[model samples]
Target: MRTIGVLGALLLFVEFVGAQTLDSAQVSAIDKNFWKTSLPRHELQWGVGCPLLEEFIIYGMGSDDLSGDFDRPHNWFDKEVYRGSRGTTLFNWSFSYLYRVCKFLWVGADVTYIGFYDVYYDKFTHQKAYINSDQLLTFMPKIRFSYLNRKYVTLYSGISCGIGWVIHSEKKEVNVVTNWAFQATAFGVKAGTSWFGFAEVGLGYKGFGVIGLGYHFNRQNRQLFKRNSL
Candidate 1:
């Protein structure tokens, strides 16, 4: 499957790319400073983006009720058919923690959830009914490459491999599908000292792009040195 290949490629890419960013001396210094001093150990992020759920749900429907005759209502008490389908990015969140392994390498794990509620109607009897919903939960152990780690700003590239489950309830039947999840690449930048804002774009289960705000609890300790001191 394409997803399987992507998962493998993402793992290899992170290792190869993270390795090429630094030498042994720089890595040693970074590791020494990390354990010898206080540094931020975790990151919590909240964001919103596209779920890309509409098409997938429609495909799963396997009928034209939701797509073709979505607006036309035939009868009630008949076989339950899709009244309509709507996709959204109203819920999305990610949490990750990184331990400095080298100047350019930070290893961590991240978990994320993206969900949306789809409203279904009963052709003629019901009006504006909200009974259908879909949710996706993913857990990824990732590796990040910090190209520039600074007090006020951070630039990084990351990759992750994980599994995701899609949960949906149709009529009275609940269907759950699990698949290989991969983040091909995520390039992002954070700006601020304590509370920061960040934006990133890449291909993944979450979406094609991500934007959010976060708070770094150990921000003060994350700064290895003052910029003015350099």
Candidate 2:
């Protein structure tokens, strides 16, 4: 429900927050002298890379149940049982698309996948309870409003929300678990530079906190004097 609202908002236009360093004359001067020439030959709109994303369950509830009667001490037989839902790791990767809604601001739609893997040795059985993980595919479309600063760097803030699905199933003994599916949500801030392109990290609970790193690419254009009528 909330996801839909966020998606709608992201689809709309956004404004960047920044100090008006360029006066009207300076803006016009740059518009005539620099912007028109540079913009036409800037970075390509489409780029592909391994985008780092941090995923957490903003809110989730799942439990495991065992299906067997244990009247005696020998309950650990060659049978099937359900284990409760343990927490998931919040690190993954997503492909990004900078959807330009404003000149300095662009909304990025990220498709991210995170697999929760747990491998531990049982002290009693001396066997491994392979809590094999499920992979989640998220369609996180976010809105970013940024200021391409005077120094030609980008400073931005993003707010995103999306739908999450279990693209790949968890295999217990190479079988998918018959468990209820869980969903998630996220939002964050970013800072860009020349040395490393850009660094984006943020917080939004998906049953836990999310932390991520995204490498910016195709960075070329900087000055935009004219009001982008888009």
Please provide, for model 2 over 7-98, each residue's C-alpha lDDT reduced to its tens digit, 9 standing for 90 to 100. 53453323221313433345756653453334222221221222222223421453443444465447556435334344454445454556
Worst 10 residues of 1 by lDDT: 49-58
RMSD, every candidate, angstroms:
6.2, 8.6
Per-model CA lDDT versus the true structure: 0.64, 0.43
Candidate 2, residue 107: the lDDT equals 64
* Top of the candidates by lDDT: 1
lDDT string for model 1 (1-230, tens) is 58855765676576556546544445656664553344355566666645554235425656434345455667433455455766655645665656656656778776778766677775666666556666778788888776766667877777878988777776557899987776644567778766788777666765667778877666445454554356
